[model samples]
Target: MKRFVVRLLINSVALWLTTLIVAGVSVESYDADDTLATVLTYLLVGLIFGVVNAVIGNFIRIVAFPIYLLTLGLIALVVNALLLLLVAWISELIGFGLSVDGFWWGVLGAIVLGLLSWLIGVLLRPIMGRSR
Candidate 1:
């Protein structure tokens, strides 16, 4: 499925931007003073993020849809927060060392992440030069 794979890659890029925006943490390191390693590390982190988001995010969103609708979509924010928390949990499990500060941090992170995703999608849709 080319479409699914494309979406998966986009998700990875989005997650990378999220970490860049929220944590200011480095993703990978190769040497004592190698920025390239850090870049690749982020790419790896992005892949992990995409997997966790794809599998876990789907379940969470489905279960929360009614709450989202009832709150006139306000609950979508909470849902996104929990999803980020879940990604942190998965990262820890996989030895990636990511953790949300708390529920409030997660909420703020989710909001920022959503905005970043929107901006990336808007700009990338033109750059990738794909018409769909």
Candidate 2:
């Protein structure tokens, strides 16, 4: 779907920005110096992240709704960080993907990634259309 593709692109851009800004959060591609390879790697990782978040994340959110409310939604940061780590582990199994230094790094990286993705999505919404 168009919306899914747009979201994937936004996630790729967000992940790219996170790697640039967060030293501890880096992505390694098949060819480190190849820009196209790096971009595709990011896109592929982003897709994996999205899928993992959509499935596992939704389940966690539903089960942990009470904690989420008690924390005033701050728990989402932790959840997102865990999701990032999950993605990292999954990517590692396949080789050539994201590498997060630690839990704190994953937390910081997830925060920045979420912000960047939101900002990019907001900016592109007009062009991409409100329905999406």
TM-score for all models, in order of appearance: 0.71, 0.96
RMSD of each: 3.4, 1.0
Model 2 scores what on Cα lDDT?
A: 0.95
lDDT of each: 0.66, 0.95
Model 2 TM-score relative to the real fold = 0.96
lDDT of 1 by residue, 6-104 (tens): 555565566666667776322333342676655555555556666766787778778877887889988878877887777667666666534577887
Count of backbone collisions within predicted model 1: 1
**Model 2: per-residue lDDT, tens digit, 1-132?**
888999999999999999999999999998999999988999999999999989999999999999999999999999999999999999999889999999999999999999999999999997678873
Candidate 1 minimal-lDDT segment of 10 residues: 23-32
Pick the TM-score winner.
2
